[model samples]
Target: MENSAGCSVSLWQKIVSFLLVIFPILDIYSVGIKGIGIGSIILCFILIGMGIRFLTLNRSIKLNPYYGFFLYGLCISLLTVLIHNDFSITAVAIRMTYFLFYTLLIFLPSSYDFDIHFAEQIYLKIGMAAGAFLILQYFSFWGLRYNLIGLIPGLPLNYAIEDYVEWMDAYNNMYTIMFRPTSFFPEPAAFTQYMAPLLILVLFTNVGEKKKLLKAAFISIVMILSTSTNGIVFSLFIWILYFVYINHDSLKNRRFPIFLVPLFLFAIVFAILILFTDNTISDYTVQQFEGLFSKNQSSSAYLRIMRGFDIYRQLNFFENILGIGLGTYKSYYATGVLTVYDGETEYMNSLSYLFVSTGVIGVLLFIYSLFYNVPRRSMASHALAFLILLSFFSSSLFNSPTYALSYLFLLHLDSIKNSGD
Candidate 1:
């Protein structure tokens, strides 16, 4: 009976842990009352429970060296409330809540027996399932082709009617009527950023050979079908970097002839695809390539750079150093401080958003935490770091639950090393 009870408890623990591992994907489509992802809503409760458990287990919270910098940044964000002459404490409180959760996750004691590799395996499987949906959608096989909009009560799921349909129409007008497979995400970019790391792991890691090859091909095709410029570029960069890294020793030892074989084959296949695949996908990629140099395109990288400078020039010395404050970009610009380009576009780059929201001090602190504080000795860690950096140019990193989870998971992995287990 004692043994049976122990087994039951263990099973429950595994089930809960697995749910936590897949929370990002599960919560991707779910939004809360405050417009936050359902996964983040669930995460708050999980953090609280874990915090209580830590206390019960008599585990002391050990502060990392960078903790002070993080808190200092948070305090600066809070100062925005006063700076704005708005007495509302909610904005500052929300920021505090997020960082607090982040800190707890970082400091909480981890189970020695917990298998991170197992968690990563489960994550990849979930990603593959999501990728399958994207593939079906790409071929117009009757999948979710509209923005998932609505509020699911008693759960943190909310969607809004926005530009998704209009954007699809524009794409149809520009290229073909084929829909970009967003899976369950709000947009193609979100889908790509969330899936990129998993796809990289499956393709490049020393996992099951047959399974990896199938997954790699599926994911690569899905990404191309999505036709997100940043997504395709990031995925391609990851593949090339992984190939070179794995073959570095061999190539350095004068195996250039052998090294060129795989490179040549990959180039040939890519060229053939560009030349002969359905014009929609190929043409879309070609357009993105051309847009790299064009200044008029909506998703122009050049426009992002120019806009960054424009926004910076608008800020006063005080505002530039300390930021206008969190959540004030729209209002700040609307108040005739400066005319923001495309008044409707959300933050184009995470790093730029950080500057706009938190100023230089905050960006420096984040950078330090990202690079100097984390343990990054392993190839896996380095790969994740590169993906995160690549993603910063395209999306808001901290706001996205999946990206936040990925970074937090890195901290968890780093904690294991710090524990010397």
Candidate 2:
């Protein structure tokens, strides 16, 4: 009837499950829904779980190494909050969750393979549902607007969007009213980040689940259609690596670099064909790649990172060592103490975001929290390796609360076993 050593329920498990499953959908950050303090909510649930675990289960606090990693982050975050009293409470809450994560509950004896599968299934379901819901809103011909000039979310709202993104459209109302299916997420990037782990879930399935795989592919493609190229590009790269590694037996024995060689050649050829078929995409890709080389030449993303570099230079050695502190960028910008050479727009590259916000030490702590929690023995080693590589280069350490979600997914898959050593 229950799971958790001899079928006794561990409340910690439930509390964490609630967070991972519900948080993405709730997306507390969308409208800056402040008040009640995010920290308060987390603390309340944490206390409840611990109390129940202690009273009912007699659970032991095993000396997990990852605890130190989280404690470090918690220390950094608290220190940041102390120094920057006006820092974002929400950001602090997000960091806190990472230091103390969902993995702890899974480490308990009661956690099983099914729990892993169940958690992953819920995540995929959410992504698919969000994808379907938003795509339906984009069908303008159906005349599905709310109050005539309908919101893409199909909701009746006074204005279509809060702000206009020049990348999408100049008119704010059109951006909002004409649906680009960002789904339950705030934007495509956020949606991509959420889907990243699901991709891993797909590859790591110990058994067949082809139908779910198809859904994941469809949702992923829909996200790309909304014009989020970076996340999807990197995600597919990771998926390719995952596919190649899983079929290692064939890779080693075959003359083909297993299937990767053909796949790579196919992608290049398809890209060439695409260049002939569609100038817009071809031109954009050429520009994005070419921009990487030019001093000021590159997509807005390259510029953002460059700008971050400019800001990083301005950070004093002490700030460099310890980091500027979480959520400190806005304050620094407002005070005219910092600058992003490329400037920040919604699609800003995340590299500079890390330095400007946390500085070096904070960055290290962030990395430690992820790599450190890796399971003692993980069969999906290549998959785990690919995720870490993809996450850092392609994403901001903090943007979209990715700092935590990325870490959570990686650690769960990284968890090692007694023989893994």
Candidate 3:
């Protein structure tokens, strides 16, 4: 009976682990409350159950020191809120709650003995499922002239056909027929952001070469089909970096071979530009590529990458050192001290959000915690860390439970691999 109970508990842990892995995608559903999300509620329950189990077993929980430092940073943020007297205390409290939740989640996998390999398998399965849906979504929309979301009943997706149409219109102003498949996400960029790190793991890690190449090819095709400029650019960047890293030993013995990757990419782009003339999708892609360097304040690229710096520049010295306050971005936005685009209150860039909301000290502590357990000598560890950091620049992911879980899972995978090596 004891053995059977142990097996059941183990099964329960595995189920929780799987749920945590997909929590980012699960965040879309609303549980009939404002400021309360399904993912957060599920996480709260998981943690509470774990807490009860620990207490029952009389197990002493020893958290990582970084979590202590993170708590300290939150305290500092609280102090900053007190000092500012202009930000919302309630907002800071709410933000602290989520931050605490995320910190505990970072420690959950190790405490529960969640297998890193199992997590990787979950990621791949998610990629495959999303890719399949994306393909069907694309064909169903373009060929059948039907929005795929409409066909699915009771899914409660956060987006509607009008939202997709608006996104499609953004990509091509003159021709609105071009459809980008978001799969389960609210937007194409979100889908790509979620998939980017998984792409890196499958391509760069020592996962079976045959399976890795096939998976990478399929994912790359999916990202391309999604038509997110961020996805396409990130995919190209990583592939080039991977090629260089893989051939570094051979290239060290020779010269000039390192330049071939860029040349190859350039050739492909040039061929596409020439062959796909008069094509709406190709023209829209080219337009977005050019928009990446646009100085216009309203361009998506500018809003995502440069707006954070603009906001950061407006901070007074004290605010710069300690930030305005946690979760105070909306309050700060309401102040109208700085010009914002599209009336969107949330900052697009995570790094910028971290800096603007948490201040310099908070940023340092967070970065240190993020890299604390990562193996310094392992190339895979560095690659995963780099990809995680890169993903932050595209959106407000610093406080996201999904990104936090992904970061923890990847680091756990690296530690496991390093120990094995």
Best by lDDT: 3
Residue pairs with colliding backbones in model 3 are none
- Write candidate 2's Cα lDDT for 1-421 as tens digits: 2531234333545445545555544433224233222433553465455556565776667665456544554565577677767667676675456434444433332342124434555666676766676555445423544311112343221122333233234333445433334555545556666666666555554344447445545655555544455544655665576556546544455664534543554365335435433455445544554555566544654563466667778888887776665444666666677665644622234555555556676566555655555654564544554565455554553433344444455556543221112
Query: How high is the CA lDDT of each candidate model?
Result: 0.58, 0.50, 0.66
Least accurate 10 contiguous residues by lDDT in model 3:
1-10
lDDT of residue 44 for candidate 3: 83
Give TM-scores for every candidate, taking all chains together and pairing residue i with residue i: 0.78, 0.67, 0.82
- Summarize candidate 3's per-residue lDDT along 83-184 as a digit string, tens digits: 668878888888888777877777754535455556666778888899889888767766686666511234333333323345444434422565556787
Candidates ranked, most accurate by lDDT first: 3, 1, 2
On TM-score, the stronger of 1 and 2 is 1
Tell me which of candidates 1 and 3 scores higher on lDDT: 3
Candidate 1 Cα misplacement greater than 4 A, ranges: 1-13, 31-34, 86-89, 102-109, 112-114, 140-176, 203-214, 250-278, 300-309, 414-421
Please give the TM-score that candidate 1 achieves against the real structure.
Answer: 0.78
In order of listing, the candidates' clash counts read 4, 13, 0
